[model samples]
Target: MTQEQVTEFFHQQLGTNACLEAEGYTIDDPPSLDTFIDSYMSGQDIWLAYGSLPVLSQQEWYRIQEVCPQP
Candidate 1:
């Protein structure tokens, strides 16, 4: 993605994170823009909120995703 696209994607991810936090989920620190760019550009797996949170059952996970879909 272009720089602007990448930046927008980051903002979306941040918004999702904020929503999850507001729902009382623990969130891990997010990566820097540079790091996110590097990983995204290289096709590496980007860190996601669900990966950072404690394991949840399939139903709960789906519910949380409904509240905060991944960016």
Candidate 2:
């Protein structure tokens, strides 16, 4: 799922909203699992991740969960 999401997010689309569509799994950043996944997946943000405090989007969050799931 994460690989698919990454492919879609990069080669398939450009917009944040478009990249994170049609996928499953809730990633609202609530549960401790989500937070853990978020931190691990933060490494994937080489392009858009910037600023002193980078605020990720819903798509980015979803992508993170998709790629970096909780063990």
Candidate 3:
């Protein structure tokens, strides 16, 4: 999905509590997965990833799982 789509999903799921404490920043009005990825790549903070991976390619699903381990 696109960054805008991801952001909208989080906005719905997180509501007012969407801000990640560990990340020390509230999600932008609309979260951008690309922006989040950039920050994470730079080691700025952990990005919250939310979505279903079954629809993605095997490699993509594995990568997402690796980044966000299941509880």
Candidate 4:
């Protein structure tokens, strides 16, 4: 999605525009979702999604751990 769309999505998902703004992100000039996801996959700390995956099934959690192991 476009930058503004991605920023709005994050704001809605995170329930706070201020959080994103505090991180030097603006809804008017946010990065694309694909870029953000790519950075996340590459272990860059460009974004944070707090409490978004609290209820992952056991198997799903294990699979995620396999893909992105803890330090």
Candidate 5:
């Protein structure tokens, strides 16, 4: 994935960075393109320092297949 794809995937999975801030989570600006692609392919749970928020907060891949209605 490109940096754009990585960023979009992040937002798709975990909403906007500002939305996260509203929920009390702090996220740094995304890194370089290659870095983002690496992270995206790593299958790692990229951590955001969100103390005091509920531990149940989670994210999933925002798949396109579930969006458009079928005929």
Candidate 6:
């Protein structure tokens, strides 16, 4: 994805980020376009900025998905 696309994808995740935060996880600000592009070009996990959350069971995950919709 281009930088614009990457930025747009992050913008689109605001709702999901809020929902995840409400569930008690910390959300990191997305990387700058240059950093994102560099990481992606180097094969780093593009989702590193999002960090990780505690695991949830299928049903609980489904409930969160209803609100977050995973873009």
Q: Each model's number of backbone clashes?
A: 0, 0, 0, 0, 0, 0
lDDT of 6 at 29: 67
Once superposed on the true structure, which residue ranges of model 1 sit more than 4 Å away at CA?
none
Q: Which ten residues in a row have the lowest lDDT in candidate 4?
A: 15-24
Query: How well is each residue in 8-70 modelled by candidate 2, as lDDT tens digits?
Result: 433322233232332442222222334334544676432321111245698876665565432
Q: Give lDDT tens digits, candidate 1, residues 1-71.
A: 98789878988888888999998998998899888888888899886655677888999899998988987
Runs in model 4 lying further than 4 Å from the true structure: 1-15, 18-28, 48-71
Estimated TM-score for each candidate: 0.79, 0.23, 0.27, 0.31, 0.34, 0.66
Q: Summarize candidate 4's per-residue lDDT along 1-71 as a digit string, tens digits.
A: 65576555655544343443454444344346677656645676655443333566889667655543322
* lDDT string, candidate 5, 1-71, tens digits: 66677666655534444455554555666455456557667965553323223444234123211231111
Which portions of model 2 miss their true places by more than 4 Å?
1-54
Q: Write the residue-wise lDDT of candidate 6 on 1-71 in tens digits.
A: 87677666666666577778887778786666677667766788775423555677889778877766676
Q: Which has the higher TM-score value, candidate number 4 or candidate number 5?
A: 5
- Model 3: per-residue Cα lDDT over 1-71, one tens digit each: 45565456445444423323233333434346566545545667533434312266888656644644432
- How much RMSD separates candidate 6 from the native structure? 2.7
Candidate that beats the other on TM-score, 5 or 6, i.e. the better one? 6
What ordering of candidates by lDDT runs from best to worst?
A: 1, 6, 4, 5, 3, 2
> What would you estimate as the lDDT of candidate 2?
0.38
Relative to the unseen true structure, what is the C-alpha lDDT of residue 59 in candidate 6, on a scale of 0 to 100? 94
Predicted structure 3, TM vs. truth: 0.27
What overall lDDT goes with each candidate model? Answer: 0.85, 0.38, 0.45, 0.51, 0.47, 0.68
CA RMSD for every model?
1.6, 13.6, 11.8, 11.8, 8.7, 2.7
